[model samples]
Every structure is written in C-alpha cells, then in structure tokens.
Target: MESEKYNADLSRFHGMIENLPCGFFIAQAQKPYRLLYANDEMLRLFDCRDLRDFCRYIEQDVRNIVAVNDRERVEREIGHDLQAKSDRFEHVRSHLFTRESRIRYADISGRLVGTEEFGPVFYCTLQEIDIPQPGQMVDRDIRDYVVGHLDEAIANQWIQVYYQPVIRTLTGELCGMEALARWVDPHVGFLSPAAFIPVLEQVRLIYRLDSFVLEEACRIMRQRMDEGLPITPVSVNLSRYDFDLMDVCQVLEQTRQKYSLPRDFLHVEITESALAQDSAVMHQTIDRLREEGYEVWLDDFGSGYSSLNILKDYNIDLIKLDMGFLRTFTDASRSIVTAVITMAKELGIKTLAEGVETKEHADFLASIGCGRQQGYFYGKPQPIGGTLAHIESEGRGIEPRKWCHYYDVASMFIRQTDRACALFDRYGDGHVHCLYANKTYGEQVHELGYQLQDIEEDLGRPETAEVVRTFWAYVDRSRKSGQMETYFYIDGGDYVNTALQVVCEMNQHLLIYVEIQNLSQSNAGRRQSKLDENLRYLYTMFEDVYLVHI
Candidate 1:
C-alpha cells in the first residue's frame, strides 16, 4: 500500500493506541531520536508527572531513559530497523530508568510508520517487568555485558558457530546439521546459547548474533568444501524477531551471495510459537524465503497450538518434530507422532524428529518412515571447526541401535497389517500375565470365558507350561537384542501362533506385545481371518494416524 493510504488507515492508530493498557510513544524514526508523542501510560511508565515534564526531562532524546551503557547498542539496533524500513513490529526489551532513579525492565515493541507529514515515525509500546531485590538486579548487568561486548566478541572472534548433526532415519546418513550460537567469553567463560540468547533478544541484539551465525555457517560450508572436508547443509535459526528488526530475506540472501554458497547450503528453522503470533505475515515471509532459494523448516513443530493449521496453510520444506513428544514414548505420544508425520507426508512436506536420545526413539521413527533424526544419540552440537575435524576422522558417526520391542512392532504392524494383537507382562519366573488385548485378540479370549489376565494362572498349569517357557525366553532375548520374538502355543486344544515384541520404556519397565494369528482347518475361519486383516489395517491406519487441521 502507498504511504498516503497507509497514513489514512493509521490516522486514528495514534489515538487508538492510547487506550491500550501499556505505555505508548512515537519518536523520529531516525536520529537524533526526538520523541514526537507520548501517551499517559508512557508518562506513568517513566514516573513523569505529565507530557511537559517527560519532554523536558529527556531533552527530546529517547536515549535519556535508556541506561547509559545500553545506548550504543540500542542506537545501532534502531538505526538498522530504520534503514531497513522494517514493516513488522520489533519487540525490544531493555531497562528504562525512572525519574526517581528506579530501574524498570521494559519490553518495548516498535515498528516504523510512514506518514504524509512527518515522513516516518517509530510507533512503540512499553511493558515494565518487576523491580529486583537489593543488589539482585542482574538483568541490567547481563544486558550491559552482552551489548557492550557483542561487537568486540564479533570483531575479536568470541562468538562461535557449533554444528549438531542431523541423521537420515532410514540409512543413518549424516543428512544435515543445525548451526548453534555459542559464546566463549574471555572473562565469563563459556556461555551457552540458553544463557545469552534471551538477553540478546531482549536487548534486540539478536540480529547481530543471528546474522553472524548465518554468515559463519555459510562460510564454514564453503571452507569445508575448499578444504576437502565432508559437509552437509547447515540450518541456521532465524528469530521471529528478525522479521521485525530487518529484512530477513535480504540479510540472508546477501550473506549467502557473499559466501558463494549453493541455494540449499543453508536452511532456516523457525519455532512454532514464532509463527503462531502472526500467521499471515510469517506465511508471507516463509514463502518469500523459499522463493529466494532457502528451504524453510518449521522447527519444534508439535510444541505449540494450531500446528495443523500451519501445515495446511503455510508452504514449508520440512517440520522438525519436537523431541519433547518422545519424552513419554507412550501410546498416545506414539500415535500423535504418527499423526504428525502422516499429516506432513500427505501435505508433501518432510518430517525431522528431534531429540532422538534413545535408540528406541530413533528406531521407532525410522520404522515409521520419518525422514530425519537429530539429537544427542547421534552427536551433541559442537564447534564448527572441531565438528569438521571430528567428522573427518570418525565419519558421520555410528548407526543408532535398533531396539523395536513387541509393542513397538505391534504398534506398527497391527495398525498397518491388521493382525490380532494383545500385550502381556511376565512376572518373576512364575506368571505370564495378559495386560491388554486388542479387539480381535479379545474375541479368541472371550471364547474361553476368561479375562485376559486370568490366562496367567493357567500358564502355570501342565497344559500351558510349554507356552509360558517359550514366551518368557523370547521376552528375555527381545529385550537384549531389541528385536521381536515369535512362538506358537496350545490353549484348550487350539494352536495359537504369536509374535512377541518387547519394548523397554524410560522407566525401565518392559511391555510385551503379542500378535495372534488364528489358524484352523475351517474355510469360514480363514475367510474371517482375511476380513479381519483387511478391515483392521484400514481402521488402524486412521486410528494410529489421524490428521488434525484447524
């Protein structure tokens, strides 16, 4: 839209924002950063008596309210936002000192507004966090340290890029790596991304940090090729904040061009929460990013709300399934994972399962045809140069152990193949107990007029001793090798063929899955079995994986 039209639409915006709960203000988009307007809330926020006092106090300079040490970084960030002509709202958190010398931590969100008369202005809001205890106000200290040292860190090379490997699930090939930012401070020692990234984002210093990581990732990819070192496409995380502060596509494109990297040499991972805030704008940005040759991935896909809507509406290259889902490794989680993967697949998008810490999770994902797996099981994220060296010497690391138990196998098979299935737990050299049995398996058990668990006591009987021995032996081997075991047993003069799969969960408990195939010399029974198989696969397919779009 043209500036005049935008101005007409926003003509009432200035007044409308005054009704908002938080502090609101407008200032010159460019330096010397004179305040053009301030709402009553803003006055109260600064502990000013009124507009006149607020104006006279700051001398028209916005920096006066900003703590002295943060002025340079704030200026740099705002300057960049202005130069970029950013249209999106930039959330910048920092300390705004009051007239009474009290410090207030403010989360300031702003965007440049074009006006017919003023040319352009910075329209912003301020939200203050609580005051700290005596001498416990370390937020400012950390903010100062980061902003003060960030430039030097970049120049003197304290900020480093780390690469965590992403493995192809089916073949366990090193498919890709995510570029993580790490700070090895000269005075403070090692600062994980968790430590300084939030501080940087709060202070709106993430642009510098994110840009550095992107360029460095591209450079490392190019350098690795030049050095004959093995390399894969590196994914660099772009903050949702990036869209507000500057033109993310332009920044990334320029960096990619500088490194002369291929279109797919670098990828982008955006968290689900970031996209949820403003789906329309984010969708456009993602589409533009993809159009510019960058593959956009929805990182931590199932970690938030409206995920199904994101998949349906946004055109993304891949979805990184959040590792938190696998923390339970429960039936519901497994079903949900299947649902997500299946949904993504149907939408012509790929799935990358994150946090494959255990061999079980990796194997489960692989068996279900998940495209990629990334977690500590493969390799922890490490420094770029060190990772390159390690990969050169060790190759893409070893294959993850495959541990598919009976339940894992049945969960996959019964849902896909439509075989009658039940689960049982073995006691200390005594009871062979049935925990739960599926519908088809329950039909056979119902014919014997006994509950599933009731069959356990019979396992000790002379007639059932053979089946018990075979089942327990198989359970032991299945747990060790992480593979399924098969055996046949006699129950009431009937031959029941079964496959037992054992899965060891996080709690160190074993779940034994039994798949039963009813074999009899009756055509009617064989026909019934075929019907069960066909109809079961269809029901389980939809049951195991249901697409959720809203």
Candidate 2:
C-alpha cells in the first residue's frame, strides 16, 4: 500500500508540471546551458520533439530570428556585461517566435529570485509582446515627414521603380521582372513600402500610386521596345485594397494602344489573400485580363491558405512562390513542393520563385521543375538605371550557375527538390503550439515549426496547436505507450498522413517524429503513386507548394 501510494504521488507531481498551461522553465545562470526542467507548454512553444535534443537549439535565440545587427550587440552584452554584473536583474526585449512563423516581441526578464530555502537559482519568464503596425521601424514622425514634401518629391521623380528580375529556369532566359514601388521623400528619404503603403491604403490613395507606376511602366516598356532592347513582360503588383478601383484589363488595354505595345508585354500580379476573399470578382477581372490577351500571375503563391482545391479552382497563368518556403527543408515541405510543381505542369502554368539567395537554392528550384527564380542570387532589386547598368556591365545573356546537391532533403519524393539548401534556425519559441488533435482514438503531444501553421492552413490539415489542455488527459494513460502511425481526417475529407516516429530536439522544444506515409489521398492504389497524387493535389491547392528532400 505504501509503495503504491509513493508511486502515485510521484506520478502526480510530474503530471502537474507536465500539464502546466504556461511555458515554464527552470534554469541556472549557466552559459548556453541545458534546460533543467521544461513544462508541456514550453515544449509546444519551441515545437521541440523531445528534451534530449537540446543541443540542436539555443536559449538566447540570437540567431537570424533576432535580426542580424541586433544579435551581435545582444551577444556582446551577454558576454561582456553579464560577467561583471552579479545578482543583478535585467530586462531584455527582443523578438521571439510566437508558435507562428512570425517573429513577435518577447520580454525576457531575469532576476535572482532565490532564497536559502530555494537554493541558488535564477527565475525568469519570457512573455510574448504584441507587435504594433509599421513593425516598429518608425519611432518618430511617420506621416508628417513624408506629407511635408509631397509635391517637391513627386515632381522631382523621387518615386522610383525597383525591378525584381524574374528568370526562366529551363532556358535560363529573362522571362520578366516584377515592379516594386519605392519612394524617397525629401524629408524621409528611402522609406519602406510598409510605412507608406498603410498610409496610402488608409487614406485610399493607393490607386493613385498604382496608376502612376502602371503609366510609368508602360512608357518605359514602349521606350525599351522602340530602342530595340530585349524586353519581356513586366509585372506590376497591385493591392486588393485598392486594385479593384480600376479595371485592370481596361487599364492595360488603353496602355497597350497608347504605347503601341501588345497586351503580352504587361502582366498584372495579385496577392493570394486578395484573390481568396474576392475570388468571384477576381475571376471576372482575371478573365477580362486573360481575354484581353494578357497574363495573370498569382503573386505570393503559397503565402496563405494554399490548398489543392484552391489551385484546381483557379486558372492563374504564373506562380510566384513566396520566399519563406526556402527557410528550411523538411520531408513534408519537399513532398508538397514536388506536388505543387507537378500540379502546375498538369495545368500548363508557369512558376517562379522569389528571394533566391544562393546558387544552391537557385539550382534546387530549377531541379523541382521550376524554371524561373527571382531574388538576390540572380540579382538584387534595383532602379531602371541600375538595371540597365547591370545588364550592360554584366553582359546581356543568361548567367551560368552550378547546381548544388542537398543530402539533408528527403530523397523519397518522386519529384525531388533540385536546389541548394540553406541552414535555418529550426529552434524558436514561435514554432511552439499545443494542438488539441484528439481524434476518436487517444491523444499525444506535438510541437511543429513556426511556419507549420501556414502549412496546416495550406494543406487544410489539423491545427497542431496543443493548448486546449485536451491532449494531456490521455498522457496519463498513454505516456508509456506503443508508437504507431495514425491518420486523421483534416478539413472536410482531407486526410493528414502522420506516422509515429521520434522527434529529436534540444530540451528547447518537442521533436516531432513523423514518417512519410502519404498525404490527402484516402489510402488508395500504390503507396508511391498515392504519395505523388496527394502531393500534386496539395500543390494544386497551394500555388507555390514546393518539395524539399526535408
């Protein structure tokens, strides 16, 4: 009776901590140390697979997630300042992961809250802070500085164009370029689109800005054509908030006649969010653009709820995959990517990748049936003057690039990711979430990466956030259990193929051990084909869906 009672109490004590609501942590004032103890909520925050994998993660999160320059300064302080300061408290505010891919602010405060009874220990809590609009880049005078010089700046042509070149992968030819709008107010020179776009959107003046850019682009394209220069289509992106004010087809039609250029010379890029909400209006608008003999490119593909049905439903001419997809490699991502490409091929749609940084990344995109890529690797977004200078200086043909092979990517996917791979900070607080995914069966814990929610939304799969305090009820019964693969119906009839493997991570967060089974398909036909079909289906849903060998 006594032995049984003792075991019950011990189990109950751990049970309480294991089921804690908040992300709880206990640590000593050690350097890059191990987690002494981490609660269940803490595990979800880090998306850590298990405690033993602590070496793979870090505490300060001073990696790229903290931004480039800020990390260096923080590290310098932690090294130089912490050495002299003893028993002193300090509050360090930095951006940390918020179980979502977005980097939200974290107020990490530390103090020596230890008594002789409690022993020598430091107590700290990392509370996530709400991020305000404009993303804190502007602290003083957001509008006054710009509004003060509205006319002089406009007249002086301070509003300039930065062309992000979009390249064709297969032929290594220049397909086109996307026109990114930039402004340099005399008072507040070199302002980000974020700072001013909100102002434009809020004040309902974005259409005016868009019109100026379109007219300017048409003039430039006509001039380039007249000069007998190599000019392909130039895409000008429009925001949904204001893009609807003007008939895109009508605008292009008029511009075509005025410039004596064909409709094929200009393209209109629309965002996924705008497209998803007003799809009916978009269908009519897009059809008009297509009917006018112009191309319609889906900008920021795979940025939001990119679903297979969403792909099948729309007939977009081009796919511009978001840059976030390249942040890391995972098996699921690899499969999804391959599927996206295959689906695009089946529909005869062109695809382009944004933010290609390295030769390896460029090569990977080309390998996965993506023939076009845009980013710093090919060339940075620059002014027309800069672009002409680069073309003239660098010579006017396709630049030769070597294909970089990746071993970290999953090799199982039928269509492989044929690009270079970059290291990502897989360990972050934002990747953590408690998904109460208890089916008719028992429940278990899972911590996914930051972008996994986007993945969930894209695949129309189960939200892996484990916080409803629902999955824990089964832990008491299933802790010492058999690991097995399971399938759950996600979003209507959508099926998420999950296998119970082992996730290895630092006590930083929980590791997710899932093996490749299949996706979306309801266990039909050959396994590989099912994998391929499901992947293709997912890609169709999410335009920029990519396959990594991750």
Candidate 3:
C-alpha cells in the first residue's frame, strides 16, 4: 500500500547540499555509475571532482564496504536479498583522510528509493556518532533533569509494599512477615529492585528506598491490625549497599518515628552468608538494631560454614536456611535435614527451613523434630490481605520426616571410594587448572584432580566422570614435573581460592593446600569496611579440590 507522498520546497534540500561540510553525491548503477551530480563541497572535500581518482581519494563501493573475497558473489547480492550475508558493512577500504574526518564512530543509515530520474537510488547518510560531548548536559532542561529528586507525593502514590509471612512451624503461626517493595514508574510500569536498587545505591538513594519500604510495610501492618488481623511482627531485608552511607539502625529508628511503629513488631532478617560476610559490620549493625528493639534473624543458616558459627558468636535472634536445601528435599535429603536441624538446636538458634514444596517434604521435616517451616507447601508468597493466613491445626510440629538419605552421609565423612586426605589441598598450573578438594578434606585423605573448565564449573559441585579424566592429567603433571603452587575451592560446594602445593607423597604432602580468601569478593568489600572476618570458607578450600585419578 502506497501512502500519499508530500513534497517540500526543492531549495530546502539544495541549500543543505551546498552548505554541508561533507561531500554528497548522486550516482547511477549504469557502467561506472557515472556521477550524476557532485556539489562544490564534494570536490573540495575529496580534493578531486573526477570520480575515477584513487590514491588520495578512496571510492566507496557498496560491495567493498562489506569484506568478502568473492566480489562477484557480493555483487550478486546487491538487490533486496542479503540472506547469504552475515557480517556488518564496514568501510572496507578508506583513505587516511577518510578516517581523520570522524571523531568516534561514523553513524550510517541506508535506504533504497526509486526516483523518477534515476529509477533506483540507494540513499546512504553519515553522521558523526561520538561520545557525549563534554558540555552535553550544559542545556538547562538536561541539567535540571540530572539533579532532580522525586517529590514525596508523587513517590508515595506510586510505591507499593507487599509481605511474605514468616511462619512458626510449632503452632503454624504467622510469627512475622518480611516486607517486599514494588515501584510503579509512571513511564516504565512496574520496576523491580534489581532494576533500580543499583542505580539508587550508586546515587546514594538506597537509604531513602529502604525507609520507604519499611514505612509502607508498617503502615500496611497497622491497617491489617485494625481489620482484626494479627500479623504483628514483620521482617525487612536490606542490602549491604544501603548501609554504606549511614548506620541502618539510625535509619530504622527514623523510620519507626516517622511511621510511629512498635519496636518489637518489626524484625530485620540478615542473610547468614551476609553475617559470615563481615563480622564487624554485622555485629555492629545487629547490636544497634537489637538495641533499638528490633529482633535480628540470621537468614540462610547453612549457606556458609562461618555463618553457622554466627549463632554462637553474634547476638542473633533467628536462623533461616538458604533455599538451595529445598532442591535436596528428596528422601535422599534425610541426613542433611537432621544434621542441620540438630546443629541449630544445639546452638539454641531457631532454624526456619525455607522453600517447602510438598506435603511429604513438610512431613519428613516435621518428623525430624523440625518445628519451623516456610515454603510453597504452606502457601505461596502473596500480597498481604490484611494479615498472614496460614494452614494450621493443633498438631505436633516436630516429627521425623520420611527422609530417605541417611543422616550420617550428609553430615559426616564416609570413606566409600578410597582413603582420602582429611586435610584439604589445592594444586594447579596458573593457566592449566587441575584442582583437588573435598568437603571431608582434612577429615579424609585422597588425591583428587580436575581441569580448568571442569574446575570452574564444579566450583561448589561434587566430583563427576569428567573430573576423573582430568584428575589423571594432574597426576601426570605432579609425578613428572614435581611440586607446584595453586589456588582451589575446598568444599561446602563453593570454591574458596586457596593455595595448595602438590607434595609427591606416596602418602600426604605437607602444607600442600593453603586457603587464601582475598576478602574483596566476600561481604566485606560490599560493606566497604575492614574487620577480622572468618568465612568458614569451606568452598574456599574444602569443596573445590584437584584430584588425580590413576
């Protein structure tokens, strides 16, 4: 369907061609496609009016622009079909002066139009597309847009708060709720924190966002109470980035005052990996939140080893499991379930199993004397309809789950294949990685090995078939070349960078493995503070191992 064509004053385009600094041309596809017309600027720019001129003047061909050895093959593709083509069209060959004319990348667009005189004219336009100019924001409108802040009224209207209930398995009571936030941008629809929090953090706007979430949550909770719903306590998870500018305690206090919220009615859930992250920062923050009457729960207890110790070290209120455990909830998950729950019990820390999906999973967990559970089994995460409503009946919460895996396997070392070095180890050439590590390392003794690709993917994973073949290679390197230094992951399934020296031990090598955590990647770098932190970094050396299979 052809649309009506509109015509403008011919002089408008003619004036543009004459004054433009770059050259412009009109060529025919007929032999040599003799230049139909060339402006004075074209002659002045190329230093020659002659279309045949080369050397200093480079003739740009549509075909040559796209590099291909077969010029005839390319010429065959001149019309509408370029299905056989793959690469982008670049300036196949340009003169020294052609490159000098453009600052950054030259922007180009091409269009084919049939003209009354020329029949078919491929119009190509070039414009300079460099980096934003130094004074790009000098314009008043742009300047105002950069420093502007969202007004309170507009912000409050678009911001929404949701909550996920924290359940007490013993009574099947909604112990508390964790506040979640959703932002609706007038222009962008709904926005997730993953999309905006980093921007806010970069601009130091996270504190304000956190405050918004907390205040809104409290307001919602208060309304729920008035509606005869009893969801009193709520937890709010915060990012380490938010705490960088000011203490979270002070911020929370301000929020409490601003919202007139109860002290004990609100709790802060800190991830276990986060606590195991920066002890000093975590201790200071938790202490202050506690001092301010906010209960602190350690989220995701079994994520890291050092995190487990936090229950004993820090004044934490609750322990939550990482969701990864849910994937292991098959009958095979029996041992791991019992071991983790037992440890949490001994520590006097309340452990909440997360991501419960099925009734059998809930049953097996209950059977193990596990009282608390949270997951899809109870209900899905949803907007608070006043208060948290859970499936509850007067029943015993803690019972043994129909757990299939024996508890001894997941929690303790069992020598099945061969005698292994209970001591963890790492050995590899910098480029060709063949690491050896295990969860039971230092508790068991064995020589393990793996290659670079195998090791990188197997960071927190167990040994596999590919690992066996790679193990043999490491053995060859060690037996023929002698001792070497390398970094590897140990256990907990996550690799921790550690130094391991391969000792040609018909037995075991001394100090063959060294755990070296840069501390830069862990929670510390994020907290932006330095303190003595022990990651219990099992993955650092325990899990990721280099093994040589003979």
Q: Which regions in candidate 3 have their CA more than 4 angstroms from the true location? A: 1-156, 226-229, 257-260, 279-281, 330-332, 386-550
Tens-place lDDT per residue, model 3, 1-550, is 0000111222322222344454444444445443344444444433353434422243434322322323432333232122212222222111112222321222333344456755654444333332335533212222122224334423656656766555554335455556766554443233334435556656666667677777778777677657765445677877666566667887788877766767877878766666765647767778878787777887767777786467667887666765466565555466776677777666555556776655666666654545456664555445776324333332323212121111111112212222222222222322222223333343322223433344434532434454334444554455566654333333433333343333433212211322344334446434733321333332245644344436
lDDT of 1: 0.68
lDDT per residue for candidate 1 within 276-337, as digits (tens), equals 77656677788898988788999988778878877767788889997678677899988888
Which scores greater on TM-score, model 1 or model 3?
1
Residue-pair clashes per prediction, in order, are 4, 44, 52
Error of 1 at 11 (Å): 78
What is the number of residue pairs that collide in model 3? Answer: 52
Give the per-residue lDDT digits (tens) of candidate 2, residues 73-110.
Answer: 33333433343356544445454333233334444544
**TM-score versus the correct structure, for each prediction:** 0.50, 0.49, 0.42
Q: What does each candidate score in C-alpha RMSD?
A: 18.4, 23.5, 23.3
Q: Show where candidate 2 strays beyond 4 Å.
A: 1-139, 144-152, 306-309, 391-550
User: Once model 2 is optimally superposed onto the true structure by TM-score, how far is the C-alpha of residue 200 displaced, in angstroms?
Assistant: 1.3
Residue 413 of model 1: what lDDT?
A: 31
Q: Relative to the true structure, how large is the alpha-carbon lDDT of every model?
A: 0.68, 0.53, 0.47
